[model samples]
Target: MNNIVEAKGLVKSYGDFKALNDIDLTIPSGAISGLIGPNGAGKTTALKSLIGLCDVEGELQVAGRDPRTSRHKLMEDVCFIADVGM
Candidate 1:
C-alpha cells in the first residue's frame, strides 16, 4: 500500500499561535479519510496546506508531488468544496 497523501512534521502558525503543531499524517491510496475536530482545531489549516491553498511549513506530498511547489499542477487533480451557507 502506498500513501496518496503524506505529511511529516507539518506545522501551521498564525502569529504566535500555532494552528497545527508538528502534524504527521499518511493516507493510503484508495482509502477514505476524514478530518474531525472542534472549531479552530487546525482542520481547515491542514486541508488548506494539503491543497496548497495556504503557505505551510515542513513537508507535504500529495500524489507524489509537493503541494507547496506544485500547487497548480496538484490543483489540476484535486477539487475542493466548501459549505457556503455554513
Candidate 2:
C-alpha cells in the first residue's frame, strides 16, 4: 500500500531546544495508527508538523504534497483537531 504520510529525518526545534530528531515514520493508506508516548516525547510537535501547523526540518509529505509549501492544498484534503492529551 502507498504511504499516506511520510517523514524521514524529521526534526523540529524551538530556539535551542530540540523537540524531535531524526524521526522516521510511515503510515500506509487505509491503515489505523496512533502516536502513543509519554509527555515531552515530541508527539505534539510531530503531529503539528504533519498537519502543517509547525515548521519542521527534513522531509515530510502528507497526501503526496510537502506540508510546508502545499499546506493549503494538503488542508483541502485533510482536517485535524488538536485536543488535550488524555
Q: What is the C-alpha RMSD of each candidate to the true structure, in Å?
A: 1.8, 2.2
- The candidate scoring highest on lDDT is 2
Model 1: per-residue Cα lDDT over 6-60, one tens digit each: 9999888999999999999999999989999999999988988888887888889
List the candidates' TM-scores in order: 0.92, 0.91
What is the alpha-carbon lDDT of model 2 when measured against the actual structure? 0.90
Candidate lDDT values, in order: 0.89, 0.90
lDDT of 2 by residue, 3-73 (tens): 99999999988888888989999999889888999988999999989978889999999999998999999
Which ranges of candidate 1 are over 4 A from the true structure? Answer: none
Candidate 2, pairs of clashing residues: none
- Give the TM-score (vs. native) of candidate 2: 0.91
